[model samples]
Target: MPKRNTGRRHSVSADQIQKYLQEWFDLDNKAKYNKRFKRYLNYRDILTILFDRFPDLKTAYELKEKYIFFNRNTSLEEAEKGLAGLILEFGDSGIEEYHEFYNLLINWNKEIINSFTIINSRRINNSFIESRNNQIERLIYNAYGYTNSKRAKNRIMYCLNKKDSYTM
Candidate 1:
């Protein structure tokens, strides 16, 4: 008999991955079902929408920025306080999903937040990301013909700035 794995040692079954693949397949199919259809919102897309509406999450961002970009002389206590305040602010924002995520944050705070403290000078630029995204969209449209092949569509997309393979 195989010894039972316990606690956090659970092994993933092939079924789980297959299920996720099928789920995404369904989502993509739905997205292409009609010309007027909107693609299903994934997690990051949903968060982007939320941030657009409620942009007052600066405290949360500052804590993340402090750890991610400015690690010169940050103490652990300061990081802890900043995270605690961010959690409190989110919880009190009257957002239902935020409260649930806040609970998860409190539960697994230690592991995920551990030294979320890496300092790098260079920050990412949105313009570059947008351009790269356009490049990828063009590649996809060309390779799979996901979008309409009208002259106007091709002209607009062809105007994107060039990118090297390294950017991908």
Candidate 2:
């Protein structure tokens, strides 16, 4: 198997476990059953054995998946309660790593909860504004030493109103 650029090197079994776990837990993996291929079958066998051998790892993995599920499925009204329940689970989990994550979540509780707010059926975010700012900065850099303010304004408006525009 080819190595992934995961920053840290892992043993073959560790890499296999990571790969299988991601494939299994991927939100976009809509297939009800995995492909009946030899490679996938081997990975499944390895994961089954690993899960049986290390129940704590299994529990941690399940808890990690719970957050992903919650984020995708919960409504804005349900988000606060759902996240609180997750935080409680993380606090009670025996895993030391989760306890650290629990503290981090607690520290950013308000901001994380606020991120669940939806407006006009879309999640509220600053991406459009940030992108516009970046575009303006690039234009300004490219148009350095320009004395024509009106022409610069027109250029900015023209560039920002293209077919693939993200403007409001």
Candidate 3:
């Protein structure tokens, strides 16, 4: 008889069940897939947190804030200590990709770390800033009822060049 090779087995965890249950009960998630759409956050990490069945939104938010600090705020070496513990908490959970990311983070050479911590630290996400400009234009449209392009340009210039605005 020829030897047969079976593929890897897949088993769902209790954490998975708890998460789905929480998702089932979440009114915000039911009303709209809120966190599913945000671009600034890592959806996978958020989903990982969702699986743990938090007691309240406040606690969930604290986890999310920690995630943001870990993933985005790369300014301080001290800030990364928590990320190591978080990655280990999911030990052998079959998430090889997450493990790989953790490895990459931990194994990064000093130059690369310094570059991200300092050079890239000045970069802020532009989506919100651009949207705010559009919001100001819309406000001009609504507040002054300026339906013409000339008025829109003047309003934008006024808003952008005002002494109160940092651009000035």
Top candidate by TM-score: 2
Ordering by TM-score:
2, 3, 1
Clash count in backbone of candidate 2: 0
Instruction: Select the stronger candidate by lDDT from 1 and 3.
Output: 1
lDDT of 1: 0.56
Q: Which tens-of-lDDT digit does each residue in 1-168 have in candidate 2?
A: 975333344567978998998987665544343455334334446567678999988889899999999978888788889989999999888898888899988998877778788888887678899989988877777677458887777778878888644433
Task: Candidate 3: give the clashing pairs.
Answer: none
Error of 3 at 149 (Å): 0.8
List candidate 2 segments past 4 Å from native: 1-40, 126-168
Candidate 1, residues 46-146: lDDT per residue as tens digits? Answer: 55666777676544554455444434444555666766766676676665546676787688667545655444743223567796776656666556554
lDDT of 1 at 88: 74
TM agreement with the true structure for every prediction: 0.28, 0.53, 0.30
lDDT of 3: 0.55
Which pairs in model 1 have colliding backbones? none
Please rank every candidate by lDDT, starting with the best: 2, 1, 3
